[model samples]
Target: MMGHAELKALAAAALLSLGALAPAGAECSRDIAVPVALIGVSITNNNGTVGGIYPEALRAASAKAGCNLVFSVVPRARLEVLFEIGKADILVPASRTAARDQLGIFVPMIGHRATLISVQGNRAPITSAQELLDKHELRVAVVRGYDYGEQYQALIKELAKQGRLFQEVDTVAIARLMQSGAIDVTIMGPTTFSGAVMREPRVAGLMDKLRVEPIPELPWSYSGAYVSRRSLKPEDQAAVLEVIEKVAKSSVVMEGFQRYHRADILAESVRPR
Candidate 1:
């Protein structure tokens, strides 16, 4: 029975009241009053995919924990800064290395084993690490900052002794370099490189032409949730770690490996040849 103008005014007033009462931070629930921002590698193109599997997996995990989770896709440089400055609430799929641990506490429950290695079976498979020494002039592409980790630093030092020509570039750039034949070798996680190649047919032949050699004694990456001590109290940090561990053990995470193709997406999302 209310007039149109009265109803409109009522709606506006209600909206303004709701806005005033809303929480200051992104709210997942009223009971657990803590802000969370998840940092991960930025995705350039999502292909209608809703931010890729890593983010998707974290979303599922956060939901299980009854926490509101927000995502910030950042470069490795910025990510390091955020953790250092106490801005990052959580870091997903973080590699466990001593250099990184110095910045914050790395939750091992979420750790995943990944690496940046050459794609095998391109033309001839690289059988041994010594082959790198023999191919002195081989052009190598690697992601910057990734080379400095404790586990990876040794590989870089060894490659340096071999006099390999390594060019540092972004992840996508590395893939493009391989596809253009500008670089003879590039590093990629098996899952990422695989997804990229699957999306591009020509890369398949290039894969046959290249050899993927797992860098040996090289520390396989262990990814997990990491939190900045600067941003969280010990109790809150411990709670977040608990959430990560609990979600890691859940059926959703364990059973969805095949569905996610996490390993393949990581390995193949790189340059073809």
Candidate 2:
């Protein structure tokens, strides 16, 4: 039997050693860098500031994994700069295009989808795909460089072949454009559009007038983790991807989303018009 003094010494040593351990965690293997840019639409709030939904989800998971994280809120224009400059370590909810594949390593898909559609008021109601086809000459607002591939570019070619044209703008501009009638219609992520409506008072009147029609099957919103040039190591990337796959198979991330945004908001947040 150990003496009381010996037992106390043992307890102290164990406690001291625990600081060097991985600590209790969900993803115990990785030490992720902080201020990872939660680069997406403004609807995705990071600790209450606007970011993407996945980034918000990632923040919670990072904490549970005992990883310290800081969020860099990035909008569409800045996203390109951040990605190219390698200024940030993480970007979530980016579409995994071959073009992006050239830029950096991405975790495999979270298997999310978003559609491209046009929103119009009840007065100018759009009921069929033909309406968009007919109005192809009109200026349509889309995120700059949003088309995912040659196939997507081919879709654009087909639209152009039929006489449709588009104007590029950030998601915020799309919302404002739709509200003020600056443009006929705009394309954005469903989750982003819904959150924009919730946050902007101008959308209420327009919401009543809004009619949505899917234009094409766009594979634009696959959620994944991104590691910039500096952060891309085989082991680090593997660990992050492993955790993403694990969290995606369960309700852990959804619960985190529900904690931050209302259910109705989330339901429409990423859904097509």
Query: Which numbered prediction scores highest in TM-score against the true structure?
Result: 2
User: Which parts of model 1 have CA positions greater than 4 angstroms off?
Assistant: 1-50, 109-130, 147-151, 158-169, 198-210, 219-221, 251-257, 260-273
Instruction: Indicate the TM-score of model 1.
Output: 0.66
Please provide, for model 1 over 135-190, each residue's C-alpha lDDT reduced to its tens digit, 9 standing for 90 to 100: 77676666665532554565556776666656453455566667776877765455
Q: Report, for every candidate in turn, its global Cα lDDT versus the true structure.
A: 0.53, 0.54
Say which candidate scores most in lDDT. Answer: 2
How much does each candidate deviate from the true structure in C-alpha RMSD?
Answer: 9.9, 5.8
Error of 2 at 205 (Å): 2.5
Query: Model 2: per-residue lDDT, tens digit, 1-273?
Result: 999999999999998898568644344344554343322333355466644555555656656555545565545556656766666556555656776676667764334444444465344554434555566545566666454455555555666576444544455557677677666665445555555565557564554454444444454355555666555466555555555555566565455445545554455333221
Model 2 has an lDDT value of 0.54
Worst 10 residues of 2 by lDDT: 34-43
